[model samples]
Target: MERSFTVDVFKVVAAQLIVWHHFSAYGPMSEAMTLQWPQLIEWLYRYARLAVQVFLVVGGFLAAQSVMNKPMTHPVIHIFNRYLRLVPIYIFALSLISLVVAILRTDIHADWLPSAPTFSHFLAHALLVHDLFDIEALSSGAWYVAIDFQLFVVLVVLCNRLQPYGVRVLSLGVALLCVASMWWFNRIDELDIWAIYFFAAYGLGVLAAWAKRSAFDAAVFWITVLLAVGALWIEYRTRLSLALITAVWLTIKPKSRVHWTPMKRVVHRLANSAYVLFLTHFGVIVVFSALWNIGHFHDPVTAFALTGFAWGCAVGLGLFLHEKAEIPVHHWLSHQSKLMFLRLTN
Candidate 1:
């Protein structure tokens, strides 16, 4: 089946928001704007984090849909292909960070990368099992990748028994379970143990996939969208719970299209770079901040401008890496995995 252009646009938008979230974390804007724009900027930061939830939902939906539609006979090969798809870019990003640390000789601590990545650490990261044993994030963004892997495993097990209607039921069940889990964890203060409540976001994605494949109803879709907007507003007014509910509903609804000439094309291209940009953009930001002493940008406007410039550089670097490194590596690893699977089976 052809990819959904609408979902593709949504994914790109979500990815940009993810970058914005990270920029807020690493940039001086948040600290600088605290006094002058406390409520507005802080609210923006919260909303930006919500964008990652959207990405997770889309990923789950697309992944479940792909597996359900194409039903892989060789599950091992499928698993291997998935791992291979992510590892090259991950390793490249890790290497880039290592180079940064070496060049700058900065004493700043990184939770993801150890003082020195030993053989075991390398193996653990390469195998994508770093998070299972409580390994810290080497890069601030790696937590999502670990969560994606875990979600994939969960989907694979569920997909084995999923039928047409089964998908819908399972998706809804997972979403509820996630909300319950989050509530329980929060009550106990164990929320930090799970590393950002990824399972919930992933469940929403699965729900989205089921919604898409089920009968398309215009009223149902609009209702879900309205509820999502309302939920987001409620989240802004009260707490974070409503946002998740609305996100689940939105995932299952088709997004409305807005016609724009050049901006749409630009968004599409940036969306393609979402993964690469997410992985590599941090290195760009770190380098720029170090060189410019961006921490000194005490004014919100100046800090925001510097953050934007840093983001642009990161996007440019990501684009270059996507064309030169990411795409080629993905092709090579995919082809190599196929060849190995054929050899092993034949």
Candidate 2:
């Protein structure tokens, strides 16, 4: 199936927003920045949480589409393929952090690491259940990965059992469940934020996949966008949960085709590297912040610039890893998956 340029563009923008969200955290910016730049960085950050929702939706749509089209008899092979895709890079990131801790003698939290490098933690991470149970942090930002994996598992089972109708029902059910869960768990400080956001956003994506071409009304689309913006503003003021629900609904419309020469190519590449970027960017920031003495750079301008540079380095490294390690590993895993499927079927 041909990939949607609209989704690709959204992915790229979302990844950039993720980077910016982290960068803003590192910078010495105030809440007034939101008031000053209502449209650009401020507003984006205010609603930036929506980007992850977009990703989850896209993931659900794609995963359901693939599974419905290609029903795997031995799903374990497919699961193993996913394991191979993520675990190596996760371990690499962990190793990098371990090295940093050893070298800097930083007062790092031991809870982040496994008590014993025993098969349990590795298996937990390999299965993407580490964060679900709060076992270990393979990478600081691995909660999303864990949530994605869990959603994929749930989606696969639902798709196989319910077929096409399963996709629609699951999508709607999860979306409602997401909202309900948020309402119920709003007071629970220890709830996993990634899981909640992923379920809601991914449900929307599944809904989009099952959406008929004629279902999209331009009038409704525009109105939804306006509502999303309005909801975001209200969210900022009242911290109401419905704001997120509105924003998720607005993102379901097909993206417009905006032509740009090198821009598309750049975004596609970034989208591919988004996983690596997410996993490794924190370490990059820590390293750069240490080197630049970000503490000394009290000026927000200097701090933001330095943070951008750090993110750039992280993106570059992620791109490098994607080209050199991730792509090759993915290819190998795909091949092995096919072989494993054949063996199992035979």
Candidate 3:
């Protein structure tokens, strides 16, 4: 199946939504703005996290594409490569976040953002095990990156082990895992630190990819959807519904094109750099919020307007960090990781 144009557009929208949600959520300004737009703030706080499900489904779809073309003969090496790709930029973001948190520790106090960091806390982030350790996350939405990595490893392992049997077997196993998540695992938020809780959304992406296959059995697709829906019905979850909808939409196999027009290129660029945006955005917000504190505006509207400006600055910084730092760091680290993997395995 050709990649869908929806993926690119969704990335851009979701990135903005998540960032805005954070913007309206964390700072003292967020509190002041709430008096003016309570309903809007309330709505964003409730629904914005669901945007993650959209990315989950898309990630699942793209992950299936990654492993479907070839068996993962070196799942270990593939996992190492995945970690290398993620960790370089991740470490950079974490360092910046740590510095921001240290500098602003006395200036701001938001309930959700990270506090003063310690050595062990930093280690947990470096290892992507902050969630597992129940450590306060250093940056907004960082846990998702760790979970995304784990989920990909799970998929790679499953496909590599089942490729001998066939795609059908792999699809069935994945669907069953999703059902388990929606029904049992997701019910327990504590388990969310693991990837199992999010698997339903992620697995739907894989299922959607298989559903598009020429050889896919129709039963596989419908059964997966049915079990997952029934689980949601038994215990309705709005977030699950968002993911369910995203997965169903992907199954449509929407039209996509690469016109490479200026606008289209911009969309494609944002889509590709969305992760960098996600990773680096929080520090931007913290830094801007610190600067925001220096002024005392008589009107909260001016404060809110400046909040909008801060949002723009955050997006711009994320883009610059991706192009200048993330790309170069990943290229070097991943190349070295591959060479080291070959030397060790050879």
Candidate 4:
């Protein structure tokens, strides 16, 4: 499937919001910014994390595109591919975070900074089970990566079982799961560590994809709309509202091109850089927090400048990792996964 410019725009916007959210929510820089722009910082601190719902919905859309209408012949391989896709960048980010924490822990008495990690702590994060294990997350948004992987596995397994039965049956099964998730699991805060809690938003995206495939008949799309409406009627959730808007917009948005070549290239690059930015930005935050503590700049202007500088550094590092590390590593892993799959099949 070709990439959707509309979805890319959503990804870029969400990733940037998450970065700003973290910037405003943590560190001495956030503290300084709070002094200058208390209202802005307060809003970001309170609301910015909701951008994660955008990702959950988008991920479901793309995952459904990959497997829903077809047989999931290699469910294990699909699951493994997802783990490979998520974990390398995650481990890379965790390494950077651990290094920053090690260098700064003694000097920084900040509550936001995590203490030095034990081997088990690092192992839990690398396995993407830190939250389930009740271990402290080394960085913000770490749980999302783990949750995304779990959601994909669930989708793949369900589709693998019901896909041979036909698209209608498969669609019905997925919709039933979404209903279960929305009506029951989503309301329970304690279940947040599990994918079922967020599956409603993710399933909204899946239903949207299935609906888009059958555009000749609008029935599927209407079902999606009604499902969302019912979920909202039961209880109004801002995150689910955002997910509904995103899924609906992505479904109906015209497939238009950016005729301007330079702008097109820039958009593509930013879209591709979104995941890397999410992974790497926290490490930038950790280093910036350490520096801010050492310098102890109290003035709002200086604080504002330093904060802006750190934000730029995070973007630069993200773009660098996307181009230099993420792409090449993904390519290499793709090749490795193909070889492993061949061996298993043969």
Worst 10 residues of 3 by lDDT: 291-300
- Model 4 accuracy (lDDT, Cα): 0.84
Residue-pair clashes per candidate, as listed? 4, 0, 0, 0
Q: What is the TM-score of each candidate against the true structure?
A: 0.76, 0.72, 0.94, 0.95
Between candidates 1 and 2, the TM-score winner: 1
Model 1 lDDT tens row, 1-346: 3456666677777777777777666634555656676775676677776776667766766676667555544566666667777778988887787577556435333332234556676666767767666765556677677667666766665555443445455545454554544444323434433533455455555555555555642233334444444544543322234335544555545555556568777776777778888888777656755554424446667766777788788888778888789899899878887787779889
Per TM-score, what order, best first?
4, 3, 1, 2
lDDT for model 1 comes to: 0.62
Report the error of model 1 at residue 123, Å: 3.0
Please give the CA lDDT of all the candidate structures: 0.62, 0.58, 0.81, 0.84
What would the TM-score be for candidate 4 when compared with the true structure? 0.95
Best by lDDT: 4
Off by over 4 Å in 4: 215-218, 257-260
Residue lDDT tens for model 2, 160-221: 55554643454445445444433443334466544554454454455445543234422333
Give every collision pair in model 1. Answer: 57-205, 112-137, 112-138, 113-138
Off by over 4 Å in 1: 27-41, 105-116, 161-197, 215-262, 294-301
**Cα RMSD, each candidate:** 5.0, 6.0, 1.9, 1.6
Task: Give the TM-score comparing model 2 with the true structure, all chains together.
Answer: 0.72
Candidate 3 ranges with C-alpha deviation above 4 Å: 1-3, 109-113, 215-218
